[model samples]
Structure formats: C-alpha cells, structure tokens
Target: MKKKLSLTSKIFIGILLGALFGIALKWLPSGTLKDSILLGGIIKIMGTGFINAIKMLVVPLVFVSLVCGASSMGDVKKLGRIGIKTMCFYLVTTAIAITLALGIGKLINPGLGLDMSSIVTTETVIAENKSLVDIILGIIPSNPIQAMASGEMLQIIAFALLVGVSISILGKKAEPVKILFESLNEVCMKMVGIIMLVAPYGVFALIANTFATVGFDAIWSLIKYMFAVLLALGIQGFIVYSGMVKSLSGLKLKPFLKKFANVAGVTFSTSSSSAALPLTIESMEELGVHNSVASFTLPLGATINMDGTAIMQGVACIFIAQIYGIDLGITQFLTIILTATLASVGTAGVPGVGMITLSMVLTSVGLPLEGIGLIMGVDRLLDMTRTTVNVMGDCACTLVVSKSEGELDLDMYYSKEENNIAKNA
Candidate 1:
C-alpha cells in the first residue's frame, strides 16, 4: 500500500508537530530530550538551514525574473508606465498602512499599561548608520558583479533591469542572452523545488529551537501590544485590501484572494518580500496580471513592499511610547510618518532591519528604544503574520495596477481555480 497525503495535510502536519514539540521543550524542565537532542541541536539546525536555503534563492530568482520581465517589455513607455504605477501603488499603500496603524495605536493605547520587566532583550552592539542618500546610492551598484557576489539585491535588480531593457534594442542579438537567462531562471526554480522538499524538517527544527527556551509567559505578558499590532494587520488585510479590490477591480474579493493564498502563506513563512517575489509574480501572472505589468510591478513591489511591516512599526512605536508614558505631539507623529517611510528605503534587504527601523521610529517620537527589547521576544513570531500581509498587499496592488493599465486577465482574475489544477485548468 502506498501512502499519499495532500499538500495542505503535509504543511499542516509540519506546523502542528513543530508547535507541539516547541511548547513541550519550552514549558518542560531541562530534560535530556529537550536539551542536546530535541531543543539544542536538531530544531535550530533545521530552521537555520531552511531559512538560509530560502534566502539563497532570493537574489537570483528576483534578478532573473525581473530580467525576463524587462526583456519581454518591447517598449520604453510600457516600462515607464509600469514603474510609475508600481511606485505610486507602493507609496499610497504604505501611507495608508501607517495611518491605519497609527490611528489604532492611539485608540487602543496598548503600551500604556504593560509591564516591561518581563521581556528579554538582545544586547548585540549594532551599527546604526541609516540615511536616504546611502540607500539611493546603493541601488546603483558601483560594480555589478560585486553586487551579485555580495547578494546586494537592489543593485542586482538595477543591473538586471538595465541589461534586460538594453536587450530589446539589440533586436536579434539579444536572443542569446535572453535564452541563457531564461534557462538560468528555470534552473533557479528547480532549486526552489529541491529546497522545499526539506521544508518540514527545517520548520520542525526552527520551531523547536525557537520555542525550546522561549517563555510563552513573556508573550502572554505583552499580549496587549501584540493584540494591537495583530489587529492592525487584520484590518489592513481584510478591510483595506477588500475595499481596494472591490472599488478598483470590481471583482469579488474571495475568489481573488483564493487564487494567491498559497503565495501569501509562503511569504509569511519566509518573512521576505524578495524571497516571495517569484511566487507573487507567478501567482499574479497566472491570476491575470499581464507579463509586462507583473514584470514591472511585482519586482518594484518586492523592493519596497513593506506596507505590513511599516504599519506594525508605527503601531509598535506608539505602543512603546504609551508604555514609557511619553507624550508625543502631532508634529512628532508626522515626523514618524516621514521617518518610517524614509527608513523603509534603508531597511529593505538588510537582515533584521525591521527592529532597526523600529528603533529609528521610536527614537524619532521620543520613545525609549529599550521598549524594543520588550517586543523583541515576540518579533519573530509576529513577523510571520506581517510577512503574510506584505505578500498579500503586493498581490492586491499588482492586480489593481494591471487592471488600471488595461493589462489584466479579467476571466482568470475572477475564476477560482483548484490548487493542483490551476495552471493547466
């Protein structure tokens, strides 16, 4: 007899087992099973490996897909139109996200009553140099090869788009380069498949190590702050995106969300827009985003698509201020909006950049950065949710932009296709 399980079943099993083992190790005493074998070794190793494997695929996948996207765009005006549309979408969505977060944070005042002594803070000395100029300059790589060599995704993206656009001008000559990259893109996706096979084992170890010593007690302690941030994400995902879809696309939200649901799940697991860009782009295209529009919008969205995170940052900052009993004036809140948006440019592509940006936000509003230490314990956990929202936001924006540009597949966008059969069906 052969045993075959559904994809959802497999993923659920991974999540369920990881959660169970994690809780056991965290709550139970220092038993041998929890220490060297279960908690100490296997879980941490697997989790780190999984994260690294996913990250390793981020740069090439983004570069190649974007290159393919640009090469497919036969005109400069299309590229320009797409870029302007994507940027507008990103900026507008980001502003909306922050406003929603800030509004809720003010109303809820989660930080006002929380006890701060219960959380753990990492004391690693970090370099805090962040500015708009540095981020802007970094986008154009001084050396393209070095950018790729160092995994500088923005720079790699810039170089790839330039090369891709120039290929169109070459007429017949660009064929060889396009063919080579298209083949490479296929190879990179193959690698993602191989990496995904180990996902369960990776998730198991990661969850185990993360929870082995993680005191849920602390989490329960700051449930108020967590609730505020989570509630904000929920509102943005449910209310805001729904309104955008209904008003802009004139499409039913359920069917649309159903199509790209898997991409959102993957993004939450990865906590990376760039890592999730391929799936996002694919999902968008399959769900009717025209190739030129998707190529233009999705890549740009991946680079600056921090809407969910920005919302969380704003809410988290306000909550911290309340907890610290720091009163911020209206000007300070406006300053936060400026800093948050500006910080996003620097925060993109940097490992663990959210907290650093949060630190900047807190500092701008006169909130204690020490309060970041309080939320640090739960950041990774909440990151899962925010990442989901980020990917979903990108998808929503792609749909609307493509629609407005007259590049959307209306039939595919509205149809609900089965997971395994979607591509062929």
Candidate 2:
C-alpha cells in the first residue's frame, strides 16, 4: 500500500509544478495561445474561483472563531493580557521590519541612479491618512450591518469582542449563545479542512496564472528594490521568527519551520493573509497551538500585523527618496516608521494593498506618489513573498501567546506521529 502524502508535501509539489507551468506559458508565442486562451480563460477561472472560495470563508471564520475564543476566556484579565501582548508583538515586529528594511535599502542604495523624469503622476485618491482620533472613532462601527456587508475587519473585530465579552460576563444566561458560537466555530474549521482538500489545485492555478502573466521582466527592472524588501523578509523570517519560536516556546526551530512551510505556500500563492487565515489556523493547530490561541491570534494578525508590508513600505520609501535626491531627516525617518506601523491597521488583507498603504507612507515622508509607479510592475511578485512573511509573523505570534498562556503542547509540536494522531483524532 502506498503511504498518503502529507498536506505540506502536496502543497510544495503544487508550487513547484505551478511555477514550471507558468514559465512554460511565458515562453509560448505572444499571441492568443498564451495571452487569450491560456492565461485569460482557463487560468483566470481557476485562480479567481479559488481565491473567492477562500474569501467566502474569511468573515465567517473570523467572527465565529473569535467569538468562541473570547467567550472561552474565563478570565477577563487574561483576555486583556492576550490582546495587549498580541498587539504589542505585532507592532514591535512591524517596526523592526521597517527599521531593518531602511538599513538594508541605505546600504544597497537601490535607487542611487534611478531616473524618474518620465514617471507620470496621476491624481489618484490616496488612502485617507487617519488621525489617532479618527482611527479610534472608526473602530466603533456606526452601523455594524454596514460593516459586515462591507467586510470591515476592525469593526467586525470590535463587534465580536463586545459579543464575546458580554457572553463571558453573563455566565449562565449566555450559555446558549456561547454554545451556538462554539458549534459555529467548529463548523467553520471543518469547512476549512474540506476546502483545503482542493488547496493544492487552487494554489497551483493561482501561482501558474501569476507567473504566466507577470513573467520575470518586471522583476529585472527593479532588482535592487526587490532585493532590499526580500532581504528584510528573509532576516525576519529566518532569524527573528526562528529565534522567537525557540526562546518563547522552547521548541526546536526545525519542526516549526516544517509546519509553517505549508502555511507559507498558501500565503505566497494567494497573496492575501485574510484568505490564508483558515489554513493558518489549521497549520498552527498542526504545530500544537491550542485552538483558542490560533483562532484569535491568526484573525487578529491578519487584520493588523503587516511586518511584510511595512518592510516593503520602508524599502520603497528609501528607494524613492534616493531617486528624487531627497535626504530624509531624522524626524522624517521616524515619521515613516510610525506612519507605516499605524497605517497597517487600516490596511485590508488583499492583493496589492501594500501599494495603497505605501501611498500613506510616502505622503508622510513628503515623497512623490509617482514613485509608486516605478514599483507597481514588480509589486505583484514582491507582494507574494512579503505576504508569506506576514503570515509567518502571525504564526510566530500565535506560538508566543500559546507558550505564555500554557496552551502549547510541546509533545505535539515536536512529534510528527503525535501531530498525525491529533489530526486523525
């Protein structure tokens, strides 16, 4: 009898084959065969359908799972601590990512000889630079129905917390509601499992389509900028995340990376952490994090933790400044970090959203928005890599919280057999 392949192995195989298939398509003649029939028709359908399937689960999963996580927290103080720690870890990592990116960009001088004379500035409406007051007020959700209809995550998070806390406080009176949410959370997690059975094909289609269309030419044009962003991502993922996992959870780094690779593949192909959340939760559980921590931290991380995006913003800001010959003063550099860190909160979990938030960062540093035009061509590919890093940050945060809360199972984390048993059970 043949052994069943693990999901991680399947996902990696899918990514390898998909990349090769895309490259083959890129080599095809420049006419209808490659552009119209292959990329536009078949590839588009498969990729878009898969993303839609994942997206359909995001809001429901976040709401139901978060509600369950919150209500299950018997102690309000512990919940508060979890919230504070989670937010602090996410923000601190993002700041570190930006700082690292800036340092690398300066050393590399990615934009030293770049010419922006021909880059035209369009008067696009930039993302609103919300003040602290505005951001606080906005979280209240004047109309929660509208918030849900629009998929407003921060508002949804706020509303869910309210419901969960109320249920926790009410005790017996809220038992029915709490039980219903727990059932709903279980249903959503089961949905994630079912959806993931087809995940290999979905990841294949998404990646193949992306590579077939975008090709490598765009990347060559801005290689330095890409390298800068990727360097920061590499340092954060390998050095920072590995260190944290070992120190905080006291688990061997190898097993964590092995489990996280599956989640990384999903995030890389989809380029949307929100879409990747269901699988992230599953991957975290497979790595032995308790469901309460996985459910809460993963959702919260998807919404606000954006170390990857911040790294790109930081690198891009520096590159643009060098191109325009604008020397960033100390205060300007600090503002860039602060603005990018805060702006990530309002950023949506979707493809190419880094561009939107980049606009905010640039404006904060008095850089030209047209500089974005230079990076747009290669942004798609960078977005994929950075998003993988973003989700890694989420997983790392989940592990940290699980350790602190005594919710992590080291035996499960270290033992492959134990993980399989838990999955089978």
Candidate 3:
C-alpha cells in the first residue's frame, strides 16, 4: 500500500511548490498570462476563499472552546491561578522576545550603509494617545453582541470567560447550558478538521499569490532587516520555546515539533493567530494537553501572546533609528519594551495589528512614524512567520500550564504511534 503523507509533510510540500510556482510566474512574460489570468483570475479566488473560510471559524471557535474550558474548571481558584500563570508566561516571553530582537538588530546593523534616499515617506498623523486607564477600561464590552460582531478578541475573551465561570457557579442549575457548550465545542472541532482538509491548497494559493503579486524586489531590498527579524524569531521558537518545553514540561522537543508542524503551516499561510486557534487547540489536545487547558490558554494566548510580533517591532525600531541616525538611551529602550508589551494586549484582533503596534512603539520613543514604509513591503512575509511563532507560544504555554496543573497526559504525549492512530480514527 502506498503510504499517506502526514499533514506536516503535505504542508511543507505546499510551501515549496507554492514558492516555485510564484517565482515561475515572475519569470514569465509580463502580460495577461501573468497579470490577469494567473494572478487576478485563479489565485485571487482561491486565496480569498481560503482566508474567508478560516476567518469564518474564528469567533465561534474561540467562544465555544473557551466557554467549555472555563466551565470544565470546577475549581475557580485554580482557574485564577491558570489565568495568572498564562498571562505571566506570555508577557515575560514577549519582553524577552523584544530584548533579543534589539540585541540582534544592533549586532546586525541592518540599516547601516543601506540607501534610503530613494525611498519615499509620507507624513503620518499619530493618533492622540490614550491613558493606560482608558485602555484598560475599554476591554469591557459595552455590548457583547457588538464585540462578537466586530471580532473584538479581548472583549470576547473577557465575556466568554465570565459566562463560563457563571455556568460553573450555577453547577447543576446550568447543566443544560454546559452541555450545549460542550456539544458546540465538538462541532467547532469537527469544523476545524473539515476546514484543514483545504489547508494545503489554501496555503499554496495564498503564498503563490503573495509572491506573484509582490515580487522579489521588495523582499531583496530589505534583506538585512528581514534577516534580523527572522533570526530573532528562530531563536525564540527553537531556543526559547524548546528550553521552555524541556525544563517546564519535561517533554522531548522532538515530539512537540512532530505535532506542531501542521499548526505552524496553517498559521504561516493565514497570517492570523485567531484563525489558527482551532488547529492550535487540536494539536495540543492530540499531544495530550487536556481540553480545558488547551481551550482556555490557547484562546487567551491567541489574543495577547505576541512574542513574534514584539520581536519584529524591536528590530524595526532599531533598524529605523539607525537609518535616521538617532541614538536611543536606556530610558528610551525601556520605554520601547514596555510600550510594545502593553500594546500587544491592547491591539489584539486589529487588522495589520503589528504595524499599528509598531507605530505606537515608535511614537513612544520619538522615532519617526514614517519610517514604517521601510519595512512595509516585506511585512506580509514576516507577518506569516511571526504568526506561526505566536501560535507556537500559545501551545507552549498550554503545555506548561497543563504540567503545573497535572493535566498533561504523559502516555499520549510520549507515544508517537498514537499520533497516527488519532489521525486515522
């Protein structure tokens, strides 16, 4: 019998072939064949459909999974502890990510000797700053229905968590509601499995379209800046994440990688952590993380855990400062870290959120907001990569919390054979 390709293997093939196909389009004569038929006709349809499909699942998946997670937590005190630990892990890692990015950016000096005189910049009007108190106050939804409609992740998270806790408090009185959420969670997971069947094609379409449309010139121009951001992401993913898994959970890194590849691929293709939450939760559960932990932590992590984005902001800040010949002091560096960290939480679920938060960080430290144009061309590719890391951070946190809570299934976690069985089943 011919062997079946693992989802990971299939996704890797998709990425490779997609890049090749895109580059091939660039080599073709610039005419209707390249511009109109391939890009405008086929690629747009497939890519848009795939993205819309993934996004369609986000709100429902987050709400159902989180509600199930919170309701399952019979011990409310432990729920509080889990919340604290998850937030701490996410924030600390984000701080570490930025610090690492700055060090890498400075050592690489991506902006030094780079010609920016030809690059055009437009003056941007920075939004009036809001107080920290106002930002915190805004998390509570004035209307839960509006929050859900708008996909306001932070507000949705807060609301879902509250509803879950209420059900738990009501106990037997809320049994019907609890059962309904549990059923809905299963339905959502089923939808995830169905949606993922289209992922390889979706991935192929998205990547090919991006490369074909954007071309390589934009990427090559900012190669150094891209390298620094990618390197920092690599360090965070392999070194930081690997060390956390080994020390915190005592799980072998090999199995984790084996499980995470498909999730990473989806995150890379979609460039949206919220869209990737369902797969992240699925992979975590298959890796023996209890549903409660996976559901609760992954949803929250998708909302606020942005280590990869933070790294990009850090590198971009340094790169822009060097280009403009601006010197940053210790106080300014501290401010960048603090601002980026807080901004990650505040800016959750916003489109083009990375650049928005980067703008905030820049404005905080007296950096020119117009400098954003320097990195804009390459942000799409970097966004895809950073989002993969963001989802990975969420899964890592899930594992860590499961370990502390004694929710990890050691047998399932260790048995590679079970992976095949689960998939086959």
TM-score of every candidate relative to the true structure: 0.58, 0.59, 0.59
User: Ten consecutive residues with minimal summed lDDT in candidate 2?
Assistant: 117-126
Q: Pick the candidate with the highest lDDT.
A: 3
Q: Give the poorly placed runs of model 2, Cα more than 4 Å off.
A: 1-78, 117-221, 417-425
- Candidate 1 lDDT over residue span 1-425, tens digit each: 98897433454466557657778767777867766676556664666556555655655665675576567556435467766766667777788888888998888877664444222222222223446576557568899988777655456657877887787667588899989887986776677667656755665555454445443533443677778889989998888887897898787776677766888778777777788888878888878888877876676666566778888888887776665455666656665676565444334543344654565565444455545434544566688788788777778888887888889887776565444457776
lDDT digits (tens) for residues 264-308 of candidate 3 = 889888888888788888899988999988888998787768899
Question: Residue 399 in candidate 3 has what lDDT?
Answer: 91
Error of 3 at 35 (Å): 32
Candidate 3 Cα outliers beyond 4 Å, as residue runs: 1-78, 115-221, 417-425
Pick by lDDT: 1 or 3, better one: 3
Once model 2 is optimally superposed onto the true structure by TM-score, how far is the C-alpha of residue 420 displaced, in angstroms? 12
- For 1-425, candidate 2 gives per-residue lDDT tens digits of 99999654676576667778988987788888777787777876666565455556655766665577567555435578787888889889888888889899889888876544332232322234556676567668888888777655556667877887788888899999999998886777677677667666766765575456555532343698888888889999999877887787677777778888888888888788988888899888987899987888888788778899899989998887776666786666666777677556545553334554575567545576545545554566687898999999999989988889889888788789566669999
